[model samples]
Target: MRVFAQLFEAIDSSTKTSRKVAAMVDYFDRVSDEEKLFAVALLIGNKPKRPVATTSLREWASALAGIPSWLFEESYYAVGDLGETLTLLMPQQSRPEETPTLKAVFATMTALRKYSPMEQRETLYTFWTTLRGTALFLFNKMLTGSLRVGVSRKLVINALARHLDRDEATVAHQLMGKWDPLTTRFTDLFPQQGTALPHHIPYPFYLAYALDREPADLGDINNWLLEKKLDGIRGQLIRRNGELFIWSRGEDLLTDKFPEFGPLTTLLPDGTVIDGEIIPWKDGHPLPFARMQTRIGRKNLSAKMLQEVPLVMVCFDLLEYEGRDIRHEPLLIRRAQLAALIDNPALQRILLRSEEMAFPDWQAAADFRERARQFHCEGLMLKQWQSAYGVGRRKGDWWKWKADPFSIDAVMIYAQSGHGRRANLYTDYTFAVWDGDTLVPFAKAYSGLTDTEIKSLDRWIKQNTVEKFGPVRRVKPVHVFEIGFEGVQASNRHKSGVALRFPRMLRWRLDKTAAEANTKDDLLDLLRLYGQ
Candidate 1:
């Protein structure tokens, strides 16, 4: 536990990637096999389930600190982090050279879930009193399931590859599957030493840069491939050895959830991997993203539900063919192969190609982006004709030029503190549209605001707060701001009878008041305008 805490401090203290990689390698060399596995899992977003509720933890912590609960709440609001607040409130104690191992400590936490809440609280109180400084903070963070430091997942993979003198892709593929920290050893992670991996594993996704300018800013239009930008979940469909696997861009195995794509196992030949977008389709048109949400997170799909919300994979690129990786090939070659395969009668219904549009000039591509909504696409995807498939973000070879977002005026209704650096400020907010004389909450936006703007709004929110619900404050809806989004849909869950995708504050409307905010009907009109 002490070594892990030191590792956390080392990671948190550095901002440079080189320093972070060195810190991870230094700690990796000092811990046991189980400790190394546990640390790897935590760093890569594989945290264990929190055994106790946060409210109970706050109460127990306050009692141990000999402070009132209200005082603790105020400190928490000021600190903007429960774990940090509790760690600071606890009196510093003597440090011990050795403590419990990371695995043993984690086992104690998981076992506490079987005990009564009172018993659990007592155990936590005793543990808090024993641990001090960085160790206490580590325990609090692990218990609350918020143990993220500055170190990123990519940095961890890079460090492992450099230490073992192995390829980065091989290290990433080994960490791709559902791994158990309790059973998997540190050496087990790299037994292959960068050799062949299991057939079901999906390759790392290739990303694009945002093109904020005209396509003509580059070179001749003939050197690029332009396709309509899809508004769906990016995924990869793997067909190997007569079995199929579907992996979301988030690295989730989704084959069972999307059984409609199961026919691909027999339709496509063995040893082929196709990359595409998983979209909600109806009558040959892409439906709103809300329709796609209905099919997500469900293992069992009824016949009626499946019929109501059908799915299709719009092929984007070909990653593998005939039991070999073809990512080294040119873009046009991969597209031609993918097109030929999708032309089959049995596979044509489930898989569709993203047909490239011909443009005589750059102005033609710019004009197409303006009318992207007409074809139910986000914008245009511009790729170089000879660019090879690569991992992660690489500039110049590919770009996504999305259409301007739909914007509307709305009022801030709720405010909450942010995490990390913004924890001391009420930077997160919920916006609302006018429904007759009352304000109805619709979308929550926390980004796209300048740091200066956030500071000003944070001060205003504290003064205008009319009611408080825990960390949330119901502020006076006097200020108006413009909200921008990509799409809108009807939702029974929201009070405004609407839901907006990727909502963010475009700009503050200092000239407008709450009365000038848009109406709920106006949003509904937008829903209609965007094929909601």
Candidate 2:
């Protein structure tokens, strides 16, 4: 536990990628095989279920610190983090003579879930006394299921690749699919010899970066393959060993969740994997993303719900064919094969080819992009015809040219402290639009501001606070910001009778006043234009 905590601190304290990778590599080299497997899993977002309730922990910590609950709440609000607040409030203690291993800690957490409340409190008290400083903070974070660090999954994969003398892509692919880190050995994950991978495992998705320059800047139009960027879940549909599996880009096994595509197991040949978007389709058009959300997180799909929000896999790329990996082949050849494979009438029932756009030049491409919203698509994807299907995100091969977001000037009416690095600053804000003489909260945004701008606004927020509501402060509506969002829809759950998708602050409109902000009527107009 101490070593893992040290690794966390080393990675968090440094901003350089090389330093972080070195720290991870050194840690991985020193740990046991089981410990290494668990470490990799934790770093790559496979955290265990939280073992204790946050309210119980807060109560226990306050009692141990000899402080009242209200005082603890105030400290938590000021700190902007529950784990940090608990760690600081507890009395300092000496380090244990023998620190527990990471595996032992995980075991204790698993046991605590079955323990009674009193037993759980006693175990936590023992942990608080033995662990100190960063170790204690990390323990609290794990208990709260908020163990986040400054490193990316790619950095960890790079470190593993360096430590094992393996290709980075190979290391990434080995980490894909569902595997129990507690039982699996590190060697089992990355074998020294050639070993067969699980039949259900999927290849790492190829992501595209946003287009920052003009389409003409990318050279000849014929060199790029254009397809509409559908606003749906990006998934890999695999037909392996007479079984169909649908895995999301997040590495979730969603075969059971999307049983509508089960026919592909018989229709598609064995050892075939296709990358596509799982969209909610009906009446020969894509449904709104909001409609798709209804089917998400639902384990048991009713017949009515399935009928209302029908699904289809819009395939774009072929990763494997005839039980052989063909990611190195040029995309044009792969597309030709994918088209031929998906041409059958039975396969066409649940699968549709992502039609490529035929454009003479950049101007015609832009015109097609403008029609993306009409088809419920996000934008157009431009892929190099001759580029290979690479792992993770790579530049120069593919780009996503999205339509401009809907923008509106709104007033900042509520402010809250941020988490992690921005914990001490008022970085989160709720914006409102005019409803007659009233300012109705419409959207909340926390990004797109420079560090200097955040600091300046933090100072302003501290001075202009009107009222306090626990962690949130009802600030005076004096500041205006231009908020940008991809789409808008009517929502009865929101007080404004609408909701914004992917809303963020575009810029601080310092010249505008609260009264000059947009109105609820304007939001309704947007809903009428864009809402399904």
Candidate 3:
């Protein structure tokens, strides 16, 4: 546990990827196999269920520190993080005679749910006195399920692959599906004999980076394959050993969520895995993304609801066929195989192949890209004809040329503090649009500002605050910001009767005033034009 805590500090304090990877590799080298397995699980966001209520934890910490509850609350508001607040407020303890193991600590946490609240508090107090410094901080964070550091899953995979002297793609593939760290072994995760993997496991998705240059800069359009970038959940449909499994890119199991696709288990050949997008289809076109959200997380879907928002997996590429892995094959060959598999009369309604778009040149492609919103597509995907399905995100082979985001000038009406590094600054903001003489809150954005800009705006927000409501401050609407979003739709839940998708600050419109900002009518116009 002490070594793991040191590793946490080392990872959190550094911004360099190489330094972080080195720290992880060194930690893996020194830890037990069980510790390495759990560490990998935690690093990849498979956190254990939080066992204790945060309110109870805060009250117990304040009692242990001999500080008043009001003082602790004030400290938490200032700290902006419960874990950090508890670490700073609690009194120091004497060093333990022996350090605890990560697995033991995890076991203790998982068992807390069986105890009563009083028993839980007593156990936590006894456990808290045995640690000091980073270990104590990490323990609190683990209890709160907020142990985040500056490392990507790719970096962790890289470090593990280097330490084990294994292929990076193999290590990545091993980490994909459901596995219990408590029972899993390091050797089981990365086998030496090229053992068969679990049938439910998915391959590491091949992601595309955004294209920054013009399409014409790529040299020739004939050398690329073009397809509409559908706005849907990217998933992999696998049929293995007469069983069907649909895994989202986030690693969520969607088999029961979309029962309509269950027939594909018999329709598709054994040991076939196809990569595609799961979209809500109606009348041969995709419904709005907002409509798709209605069918998500419904374990038992009503027949009426399924009929209204039917889902179809638009196949893009074939990953496996007839029990063989074909990811190394060229895109041209893979697409041809996928087309042949999806061209079935029985699978027409449930599975549709993403049709390749034809264009004479880059100029024609650009012109077609402008009309992507009409077909409910995000934009165009350009894939190299001879590219292979690689792991994670790689440049040069696949690129996403997205349509320009819709922009509107809106006024900053409320401000809130951010967590982690921006804990002390007013980095989150609520934007409003004019509704006659009233200002209606439309969107809240928290990104797209430089460090200098955030600091400057934080100062302005502190001075312009009109009223306080807990962590949120109602600020005077004096500054205007250009807010950008991918799509807009009519929403009864919003005060403006509209909602924006992926809203973020594009730039600070210093030359514009609150009075000159866009109105609710302008948002309604966007909904009419882009709304499904």
Candidate 4:
């Protein structure tokens, strides 16, 4: 346990990717077989390998070489993490006085090997029985890859520096060295100060925090820089010390996902990172989100997927340029620097040219977003020119001024039980539109209603069930709710040849009659924007 803690401390210090990887490989090479099993599980994080499904101890144990899921469930119910469970299961003397940190556990776990099914189950059970209180909670969070300490990866980098008495850049290098996160150790690969590390490019640092009310009035739309709110992944392209790193908003490295932008490496200003959105675009407009979904996580994509969902980098904000860190600079300053950095808009791949557009009023911005469906856009992004880069949440500096959703008062025709907390309640719903004389099922949306509303609806579903299709309960089409969506697209997969983007229930339209529900023509109008 102490050894694990020490390794985590070392991994914490490592900023360079090489150092982290080296540490992980070294640590994994040394642990005992029993310890190795738990270590591997820990490396994979405390979360179960997949979504929690119905399982018995014998069945699960058999699958994991005879280690029962009960063991893990017990440990998770106890200490929360498998490591702590191991600690609890071990003899008191074997349990180290000091608990190891998460990073140490990560390093220790990565160096280990695949455990037998039985040993894995035993380890899991022991882990649960031993872990307790806050430790258990943190362990559970780690299992889900969410340490939720309000800590960002950058903040972790800072923590590493503080732990190792090293500079940030040195530590950053150690951090970025490997692709396999499980095996990287931070301590052994810690870089010395002033090391010729990878140069990081300037990327926009996005900050969005929800406000109780509007943050700023914008005076008129004229003062704001408004651009279409694209429905795609946000990308941060960084070029530091000549090495290129492109990251998603979720901080996942995505350089390999879009090869078309790879050539832009030569044109990019070194030691810079810029923020942008990566969308599927061809010819002159944006592609559907489903198109880009095809090529997202593949290490090597099929040629069909590549041609089907080609990518475009829609550059938004610039954070770093040349050698200067412009995150501290105002948004207006960053815009000017970004403009000067990319001299050719015509050649740039789908850059969000908000500066050139006349945003002179919020209404104009809203109007543009309203018509954005024509351009296959989600909505609009309204940014304050004077704001500086701030991490996490909506600050006053930026706002996503998306158009109001495409709403329809629809009748709830079916209901199904939800998972986890709502496992007993019929919360999932299948909504329909009154087409001609029949209620044709057009969508199934389960979210957007409150727990109270769900409970009420749950009772109604049970009392009104006309028929049951396994877990799904067919209900009378008497309830009406307003459904909201980002965009509508035509699809042969459905009866209406219409699919809603980001569909969610806004409110129960009890005030509206079934006859007041949106017509099939409304769906057709929106789908026409997709050229179907």
Candidate 5:
């Protein structure tokens, strides 16, 4: 735990990726294989489940500290971090304690669930007293099941790859999918050379950069293949070794999540990997993104749900065809191959082709970008026809020209402390729009304000806070801001009767007043216009 704490501090404090990887490698060099595996898992958000609920821990901690629950809540609001707050409030030990190993601490968590309530309280009280500083903060994080640091899983994988002298992509593939650090050994995970990957696992996805200039700046429009930028999950549907596998961009295997696509294994031939969008489509057009979340949010789909959110994999590019790695082939060739694979009637419904658009010039492409909202798409994706499918985010091959977001003027109703670096600042805000004379909460956005703007807002929030509710503050509805959103949907769950998709602060519209802000009617008009 102390070693992990040291590594966490070193990694979290460092800004550069090289320094982060160095910190990980430095710790890995000293730790046992089991400890190293656990470190990887912890870094990648695979923390042990909470042995005891945070509510129980909090109640016990407040009682133990001889502090009122209200005082503890107030402290938590100020700190904005659950783990660090609890650690600070708890009484220290009488004598210094030996630091436990990472594996030992994790073992204690698994053992804690079986203990009686009183026993659990005693165990936790002792931990609070015994653990100190960064270890305590990290302990609290693990206990809460959100042990995140500054480093990414990619950095951890890169470090492991460098340490073991293995291919980075190979190491990344090895780390994918579910594995218990307690049972699955480091050697077992990364086997000796010549071990074949499980056929279902997907290759690294090829992402595109945003197009800042007109398409004409990139040369001829004939050299580009244009497709509607889908507001859907980036997915890889693989038909390999006579089995089908669906994977999200997050590397989560969604084979069971969307059981409707299980039949595609039989439809597409073996050794075919298609990179495309997983979208909820009913007729010819896509349903709203909020509608798609209905399917994605559930682990198990009911019969009614399956019918309600019928998703189609809009197949576009072919990575693997006929048991050969064809990613090096030009996208033009890949598209033709993908088209041929989905030509069958069986695949027509299950695997829809992401048909390319014919544009005479860049002007036509720009025109299409503005009208993307009609099709419920974000905007245009321009791919170089001759460019090979590059790994990760490469600049030359592809570009995404997203449409301008729908803007509205809304008043900030509430402000809350954010997590990570922004934890100390009141960055997150709940905004409201007019409803007759009342201000009804519509959306809560946390990003899009500049650092200078945020710092200035934070000072103002502290000075003008009208009331406090745990970590959130009900602020005076005096500031009006321009809020930008991708889409809107009618939702019975919200007071505004409509929900904004990807809502964020465009700018603090100092020019406007709360009285002149947008109304519920305005949001409803947007819902009718775009939430089809």
Candidate 6:
């Protein structure tokens, strides 16, 4: 535990990516088999279920320390972290000179496989209480899923192979399979050395970063492919041993959510891994994101919920197919193979593709993306035909070419105090545009405002409130600011010429004069540019 804690501290303190990767590699080189496995799991972010209640940590600390719940409540004020409070309460002993490797700890956790889920939870909680402050913080960070250490998964994978004296690619491929550090097979592979075996897990896609931009000069839309940015969950579909497993981009297993797609296992070739977006589809067209959101967290959805949000898996890329890795294959060729294999209409479709003639230049792609609002698509995706599925945002392989957000400069017409810390001050804002020289409010925004700005404006809003509308207080329209949005569409419900899509206050423009605020003409111009 102390060893893993030190590794975590090393990772946390390292600012450079190279340093962080080295720290992880060094830690992996030193831990036991079980601990190594657990460390790997922690690195890749696979943990058991979390407690249902926010106060569960406090309960664990209370029970472990033999202190009453009230005592914890009082101490919590002094030490904000539950684990920190427990560390302070526990009796001091000589710190162990030999810290167990990540492999050993993970092996221990996994070796107690006979324990029930409740027992496992209790055991984990007990283990957490025994750690020192730094170790405890590291464990909590890994458990909750954010390490904040800036190392990339690719770098870590490389470091692992370098330390183990194995092929990095082979090691990376092995890491993707089922992980259990304490297994006899795992222990045998690494031997019971200083470290057992490092935990191996798949990397999260959303967190991957791209290195560079595609040249603004790629002519011919055929050289690139544009995809609708579907407002659905991103997922990776993995097939092994005649069963299909659907994993959300958030790393949540969504296999049971859409049981209709269960038949896909038999249809798809062996060892196939596909990446694409998952949305609830019925008949032909797409369903609202709200419908899909409804089916998300429930362990077992009611039959009614499944029937309502019946899902469709849109296969986009064939990462691996039929015991063969095709991620290195050209996208167009892989796409052709994908179409031929998954002939089910429910599985594949030639998504609206841009004509080869239209996107001969960046301006054209930008124009098409700007007009994508008409087709209910978010933006475009640009891919190089020769690029490989190299992980960690390799340049040239892929690019998400999104249209710049729609924006307008408007005047702040009202403000109010936010809840919790800002309850005594006004931080929320109601903004307006110029309507024939008159200020008319169209939308209200609370987020995107900075803490310093919120507190400062909160004081002013309270002093300048001209009128009250229940919880909202109308204030003098003296501040002019810029707001950004994804898109704009006509809305009869709104008094303004248009309604903003995902409107967010970008920044304060105090230097600008109130007369410079957007006018009715400006709104009309934006509505026209919305390409409806």
In angstroms, the error of model 4 at 179 is 8.4
Per-residue alpha-carbon lDDT of candidate 4 for residues 410-510, written as tens digits (9 for 90 to 100): 88888876643455677778888866777777788989999899998888887998986655678877889999987676667667667777789999987
Question: Stretches of candidate 4 above 4 Å error?
Answer: 1-48, 51-204, 209-216, 220-223, 297-309, 344-355, 359-363, 419-425, 435-438, 466-471, 491-497, 512-522, 530-532
CA lDDT, every model vs. true structure: 0.85, 0.90, 0.89, 0.61, 0.86, 0.64
In candidate 5, how many clashes are counted? Answer: 1
Please report the TM-score between candidate 5 and the true structure: 0.94
Q: Which residue runs does candidate 3 get wrong by more than 4 Å?
A: 94-98
> Model 2, residue 174: displacement in angstroms?
0.6
lDDT of 6: 0.64
**33, model 4: CA deviation in Å?**
23
For TM-score, the strongest prediction is 2
Deviation (Å) of 416 in candidate 6 = 16
**lDDT, candidate 3, 1-532, per-residue tens:** 8888888889988999999999999999998888998888878877778899998998999999999998998888777788888888878777563458888888888889899999999988877777778888878888888877678999999999999988899899988987778878888888775799888888889999999887899989999999999999999999998899999999888898998998898899998999999999999889987888888966679999998999999999999988899999999999999888888899988999998999999999898888888767988999998999999999999999988889999999999989878889999999999999999999999999999999999999989899988778899999999999998888787799998999999999999889999999999998888875
The order of the candidates by TM-score, greatest first, is: 2, 3, 5, 1, 4, 6
Per-prediction tally of clashes = 0, 0, 0, 70, 1, 26
Give model 3's clash tally: 0
Candidate 3 clashing pairs?
none
Could you give candidate 2's per-residue lDDT for residues 88-158 as a string of tens digits?
Answer: 99886665634677777777878899999999999999988888878888788878888887789899899
Error of 5 at 169 (Å): 2.7
lDDT of 2: 0.90
> How far off is residue 279 in model 4, in Å?
2.0
TM per candidate: 0.93, 0.98, 0.97, 0.67, 0.94, 0.65
lDDT (tens digit, per residue) of candidate 6 on 415-516: 754542344556667788988868877767778878898877877876888987645678888888898877566667656757676788888889897889
RMSD of each candidate?
Answer: 2.4, 1.3, 1.5, 9.0, 2.1, 8.2
